[model samples]
Target: MPIFIDIGAAYPNDNRVTLVVWGEHYDDFAEMINAVDHGNAWLSVTSYLEVYEGSLQMNSDNGCDYTWWTGVG
Candidate 1:
């Protein structure tokens, strides 16, 4: 199964983005980067994380719920 995330959820209902991820990237995330728009918001495997952008993570905790940056120079 893919992951699901809500972006800009606090904004107007129509402004919200529901992201789904099966592998590397999320649906709109690619659009923001000028890539093809598909699937939901994606997550880098914990192994790919260089920095965790969120306060909580860990597979036991809702399966890696949080944000992260990978391969930062």
Candidate 2:
């Protein structure tokens, strides 16, 4: 089965963010996120939406949400 990860932003606030990594193996998803170094960014988990598998989706009320899904063909 193909693995999948769904990450979504909960609130508009920078602190009220949510990051979820789901896939056939949780470790893979976690590793991907950790590799990105998301902690360096100013935006919190709730600032955008990210999905790994096919495409990446990002939404923000402040007009600064950015998401990039690499290694997808």
Candidate 3:
């Protein structure tokens, strides 16, 4: 299975696009963001989205709201 990471805007006041990056491309993704920030004088440090390395998994078995079911019995 491929791993995925969630990335979202660091600041709401600035217009930005939230995206998910493949784990394999994480370095490239972060580099691009940095390049844009460095090249643009108007863009502030907080204008970029932060990458979340981890996620919370919710499952129905323990009072969680989510459930994943395989069709096999």
For model 2, which pairs clash?
17-46
Off by over 4 Å in 3: 1-10, 39-73
What is the C-alpha lDDT profile of model 2 across 7-71, one tens digit per residue? 33334434333444434445434555554444332323334555434345433322332344544
* Per-residue C-alpha lDDT of model 3 across residues 1-73, encoded as one tens digit per residue: 2222212334342333334334554454455444444433222122233433343221112221111222223
Q: Predictions ranked by lDDT, top down?
A: 2, 1, 3
Cα-based lDDT for every prediction = 0.35, 0.39, 0.32
Alpha-carbon lDDT of model 2: 0.39
- The runs of at least 3 residues in candidate 1 whose Cα sits more than 4 Å from the true structure, single-residue gaps closed, are 10-12, 23-73
| Candidate 3 lDDT score at position 41 | 22
Q: Could you tell which candidate, 2 or 3, scores higher by TM-score?
A: 3
Candidates ranked by TM-score: 1, 3, 2
What is the model-wide C-alpha lDDT for candidate 3?
Answer: 0.32
Task: Evaluate candidate 3 by giving its C-alpha RMSD to the native, one decimal.
Answer: 16.6
Question: What is the TM-score (0 to 1) of candidate 3?
Answer: 0.24
Which of candidates 1 and 3 is the stronger one according to lDDT? 1
Tens-digit lDDT string for candidate 1 (1-73): 4553444442234444434344444442333323222324333333222212432222222233434343333
